[model samples]
Target: MALNSGNGTVPDSKLGDEHVAVQKLQPDAKIYDRLMTLSGFFKQQYGDEPEFYVRVPGRVNIIGEHVDYCGYSVLPMAVEQSIILAVGTNKQRAQLELHHLDEGKFQSFDCDLSDLEIKLPKTGGPGWYSYFLCGIKGIQEELNDKWRPIGMRIALSGNVPLAAGLSSSSALVSAAVLATGHAQGMPLDRKQLASISASCEQYIGTHSGGMDQAIAYLAKQGCAQHIEFHPKLKGTPVTLPAGSCFVVANSLVQKRKAASSDYNERVVECRLATRWLAKSQKLPNWKDLIRFVDLQEACHLDNDAYVKLIDQQLKKSIYTREDICEGLGITEQELETDFLTPSTQHMQQFKLRQRALHVIQEAGRVVKFRQICEQLQRRSSKQDIEQLGQLMQESHHSLRELYECSHPDLERLVALSAKQGVSARVTGAGWGGCIVAMCDSVKAASDYVNVLKREYYAQLPAHLLERYQPNDFNEVVFATFPSNGAELFVQ
Candidate 1:
């Protein structure tokens, strides 16, 4: 696929706005087939040509793990796998039409545009279309009085593996926001789109750290972005060391972050720990400092000193409800109301110290990771690789032991990677998804993938073996470089 674009172009997307460049994706090879198929699907579904299209790539975090929500910076780059949509303004009726190619996992949904509501399930992940509605609703609520929201006809096909920590869900929400904003003639800002998408995804019920949404809109080709949330939301692109290729390997064990309370439980624990430490230190506004970043700043402690303070103050490995309530001079009802999210209201032990330590140290690793890459600046050396690789190794160990987010399958991949002289770590929200490994070169990546195929994927039981074959190596593991974020295409 080739993109005919004007300014920093892409191999896809079409739009004629001032902010985004308008281009056509010419169908010259198999890479362009998905776009062509989606175009045909749009015609068959809506009986008209699509006005424009949106392409949102999924991302793979290189080093930072489980620290984005703490209001810290994260290093992530966009991948080739993406969600593409064929969109046009609806004229037949005031209804939004959403169609997905995967009929087995999803069914076509249509809803009235004038009255938009995202209905979430009581348990498990919500329907796929519910996420799309989140984007449309986000834009609809934000638009000024000059314009009324319009219905749209959309047909989307995504290759990003679902529930694999690839942010396939955030990709859809962002595509919907971009497509809808374009249809409404709204001047779209990438940062605003990222912020809105992050806020709206809460409708689907997960308190995410916004790294997925930020990279979805802010990513540029050939470099990873160091996105920060404090002071203001911003992204800075950093060049990776020369002669390095990062390989992402799926563990084949899926945990939907929204479906389980484990993710939210961690978020609550971090918040509770922040408040516990803040109030203990006699900060006047302890309740206001729910995030670890805020607590650290309030205490006026450097990163190392903050860790020391946590060690000295948060002495217990686990704190019960009564323990926290008594220490904070609050009742159980207040703790339940102020400290816990609805999903994490279950009475339980809290690993305040461990969770706080992971966020603090992992945050330090992100800064160090970016610094090492910046220092290398297209240069390469054995010591440079060791420095960068060591950081990743430590990150995974911390996630597994301290954060308690790594899964057995993920650790197995990490182990196999270690044998190959590569450093791998659990990358996303982490309860069993993907491990991103640092390879010295492209050839090294290829060899590492082969090693994993024989040691890991090849040993799967007959049931899973039927799903992943030897020939489908790219599906299980592949080398990904930085790619363009979100682009719009005009027909």
Candidate 2:
């Protein structure tokens, strides 16, 4: 029961980076407690020594929420929050052992890399842990003939909230992939790992656009990335204005599965729009256009339908015959072949016209926004900071009106931000989640947190309250251009 006494090596309780940095730092405390806790269970079951531990972080979308799947740009940063895993390798047989910190339960499964088929007693098990295993199956597929031999024991812990739209599940899988890859001495680059992790995430039936795994594999300390997804994955650093901070406030409201159909439903609509766009653009497929939304617009459908449910009025709403002719610069006879009935009609349209425009425009804005931040860095000016804030406000409004991701909680947060004269917006896929706000002044941030605490979150359910409060001043995040993908750390 002594702290830091695992494996007969006493770790200096005060000697780790985490402990020194966090004021009450105890690196070995977590390690020891997990080891002792896990060792007792393993002894009672398999009677063996566990292997190494692993850790990975969940991320927040600073801007560009649901646009990743649309083949557009996104700005996301990995949060300090992480999922820590301790794995005990048992290569004795074709099997894997797993455990969770909170559930305190053990699961053993045969290590069948070749089958890749899942035998789930129930479709959904526990929280997001099932998705983490799916990522492993994905890595197995990548191995082809070179799949290694291994069994695993895992202990999981972290502060990231599940179903909050943060990349918590992805982080756990990334960590598992990294740990397994390292333990087996398998050679996989960050890109390979990212691809594998993303592929696995898809197996869970959530068809993500690869942004989370890419960032999880490539993130570094102190910066945000602007990622461009398509034919090839490329990332650039998002340089933030000097003296500005990246502040994220979790709404603590989990998006309910049944109530949150709007999210994935829009994704399906976007796919349909792309098919229509491909036909209209005279291209073989929407994939040929390089941009999904652009192809959607070319089809003469309102773009917002892809982000939210577009009403019948909005669907019928269109430019006049003359306007269409003028817009595309073609007569009605030419328009029939060019615009109407192009072998790809009868599509279900969501009211994403404005949402589509916002994504396209916002993708462009990210570039300009980066340039502006760099310009401010060169000159050290406050005007550009305010300008950036203006852009954030604009982006939020566009997401609200066009993207339709903002919910009532998001709006209240935005309104509170406006009163403080700070620029803030719904930070993730919206519809319900957290908001990212740029504090005009440290004093203002402090005051806003006070109001938020006093009015809204304080009276909520006893279990739900502020995870953490904001300070008065904005903490400036560098937010440079692209960085590396998710990676493994070995000593």
Candidate 3:
């Protein structure tokens, strides 16, 4: 079925049960107003109105942190904030033209769709357009030789704070993929799009484990998704407790995964740990196994059994590069080329034990978190709810100490959240980002926000504080519920 047409209506047949409801555009609506503003900008820039709009929301991982790439389930919800695009297809031209709404922040770029090139910098991060190119190239490759690349004029605007541990970059990449697919008349399958977006992001050098892209396209309103990976991509809507809500607060300490090797280094450590465990088990094809989940499956062990394996096998807190190479029986060159990511190739040390422990234990926490949410639906009790909160706190501790991914600012925010009676953990890829705090009641959430504003945002420089008005403080730190996933708005 055609996913979208010139008409404003989106057929439900095109959107299967895996996707969220599609809404028609109304000019007077707030969302439409923003789209129109972007469309106007597009017209001014390219001398033509946009054919359609695409939106993909940023996500906040509530309970699971850094375990997604380990091939485990994660609990995350889509944020209302997202990356929005106004796109007009150019059938005659073969170049993709991109314009950022914030022109001063990101310079505009035009590239040939048929010959896309994404080059990472020797140091620092790749250009912003490199991310867009990742998505475009992904769609091109997914379609194979059948893809007749089309040129398009695009204007982009986003409210998801950049490098704030929120999936802003992933959302942008997803939006780009959606726009490119729609422009080329490709099928719109949420799962397939999520998979393509996930794989495409690796082009820019971050080995993200499909969580951001999954939640970006799979999320439904009013419920956090318990997304499971491994056999296949699936998301089950998990309604949060009635009395509690989640609030996301940015530390304002930007952490771009592409800019630093910290995120990928942890990923490498987990992979090495997985291989070491597999080798210890003498499992066939142990050398080929990279993900912890895959190793766990190979062992046919339960969560507790896996925890025991960690204790018995991964005895050391740290494993030097030499130790890993010796244990795996591979030369440094082979290890660097085959196992390590481009960014983490320079790292000489690996925290195999700690990183592996965090992955195994954190995966268990995710299962427990989903189970608690399921239990709450049948019976809500104070103790059961507190158990869930305690798990969140434990998850944060493991992330901070075991994974060594938490930053001081994030720790301070988590500490402040604890004092406010909210159980919080650093969300996203950590190192420096936002914290997802769980509160018991709406009143409690309001009070928590106030405390954070006074204690956290108030301490910021006067220039930074001046940017936010009294009423607009919620933009930086406020309660959020599950939002609808990606959608296309056709005119």
Candidate 4:
């Protein structure tokens, strides 16, 4: 519980100039409480004190959704809410044990380090520990039998809302990667960890586009990140507009993305749309171009030009299998094999136009959003911030109308936000999650939160209504400030 328990450290790294920084713990009371509680649980479960702790923050996308796999940039900020793990090495029989603070919701899971595997359910996604395994296995795959990871005992405490738009799951995965890699003394930088964590989530059956994992490691304390994935994994910090505050409000409607194919289906649609447009334009390498950003470069078209091409070519409500096969000069078997994922193989109809439009346009909004933020950074203006808000409104409309990822609960929150003169949008994979709203000032955010409480949170279903407390309302809605990325705390 003491801030001055001992010295913490960043793992040894010879390949990079900068790794995830390790420093002495600062005196923050809220964080102190979470760590102290987790430490107690760790001792009770593992019969020993923790060697160190890992802190990985969840993120809220400011603008741009569902475009990272298509090689586009995203603007997301790391929030203070995080997944903290108290980790200790277990030299006894090479075993991995995981204990969750909320034992009622998440049961414990253990296995041998040599036999690590993620067992997903037949219907819904895997349990919370499965994500942790993804991270550890990713590092092991990188090692490729050259090195074996040490055993570990971990106790996790997280405040990030589960199955919400925030990157709670990604944060957990990143933490595991960090904890494992560091505990074994691997020289992995934030960029390396981000990339590995992003790819490993595919093990859990959700096709993440790397934005969530990138922000999980690259985020700074006071700025939003413009995370680019096309050229390379890089994060450029963009200062927010003056007097701006981001407020996250949960809809209380949770849907595990891995439970269904909705998230992967969109990824497939974008690929299909890309190839269809490429072939229609008589490009020589149509089959190879599966991302819009690459297609734009191949055609020498700017964002607007590529968007116009999509408008002209992908004018189909539903492109049946035969329709696409004849157009692409491929057989039905080839189409199923090349274009669709295992989960999305059952699809007969494809909304290529709408899904492609949302991605291309939302990517443009990301660029414009970062541009407006840079402009405000030079000269503070109310007009520029409002322009940014308008772009968010457009992005939300695109997600709803074109992407079809917005839920009715999300729409209700959006309508309520509009009534209060705020701009809000769905943040994550977005079938059912949280809505992020932008307010002009702290006072405005406070008033907005109060309004949301009386109008939205108070009228929840009976199950959640019984658990409500007036003073502990942050879990439902809160004004979030940008926070630092993953860190290591040792004792």
lDDT of 4 at 116: 84
Tens digits of per-residue lDDT for model 1, 1-491: 54444333353233332245555555552236777789988898878898887899999999777788888899999998999999878555678888887767789999998888888888778888988989988888788564465778889999887788888889999999899888888777888889888888888888888999999999988899999999789999999988899999988888888789888899888888988889989998998887888987777878899899899889999999999999889999998898888888895899999999999999999999998888798555678769899999999999999999989899899989998889989988889889999898899999998988888988988877887785565787999999888887764
lDDT of 2 by residue, 1-491 (tens): 22633322343444331111111223444334544555465555556654555556678776676677787777777776667665666666545656565654334444454344654333233345565567667767777566776766665666566656666767877877776676566665666777778777655555567788778766655677777776567766666654565556556666632223465555654554444335444665544443464564555544344333223312432335555444344676754554343222222344435544566567655666677767976797778787878778888888888777778877876786687677888865677767777765555556666666665565556434333324221211111222223432212
> Which prediction has more favorable TM-score, 1 or 3?
3
Error of 4 at 165 (Å): 0.9
What is each predicted model's overall lDDT from 0 to 1? 0.85, 0.58, 0.87, 0.87
What TM-score, computed on C-alpha atoms, does each candidate reach? Answer: 0.95, 0.73, 0.96, 0.95
Candidates 2 and 4 compared by lDDT, better number: 4
Better of 3 and 4 by TM-score: 3
Clashes found in each candidate (C-alpha, N, C closer than 3 A): 5, 36, 0, 0
For model 1 the TM-score comes to 0.95
Off by over 4 Å in 4: 1-17, 26-30, 470-472
Cα displacement (angstroms), candidate 2, residue 207, comes to: 1.5
Which ten contiguous residues of candidate 4 have the minimum total lDDT?
Answer: 1-10
Residue 412 alpha-carbon offset, candidate 3, angstroms = 1.3
Estimate candidate 2's RMSD in Å. 9.1
Q: Which order, best to worst by TM-score?
A: 3, 4, 1, 2
Tell me how far the alpha carbon of residue 299 in candidate 3 is from the true structure, in angstroms, after superposition.
1.1
Highest-scoring model, TM-score? 3
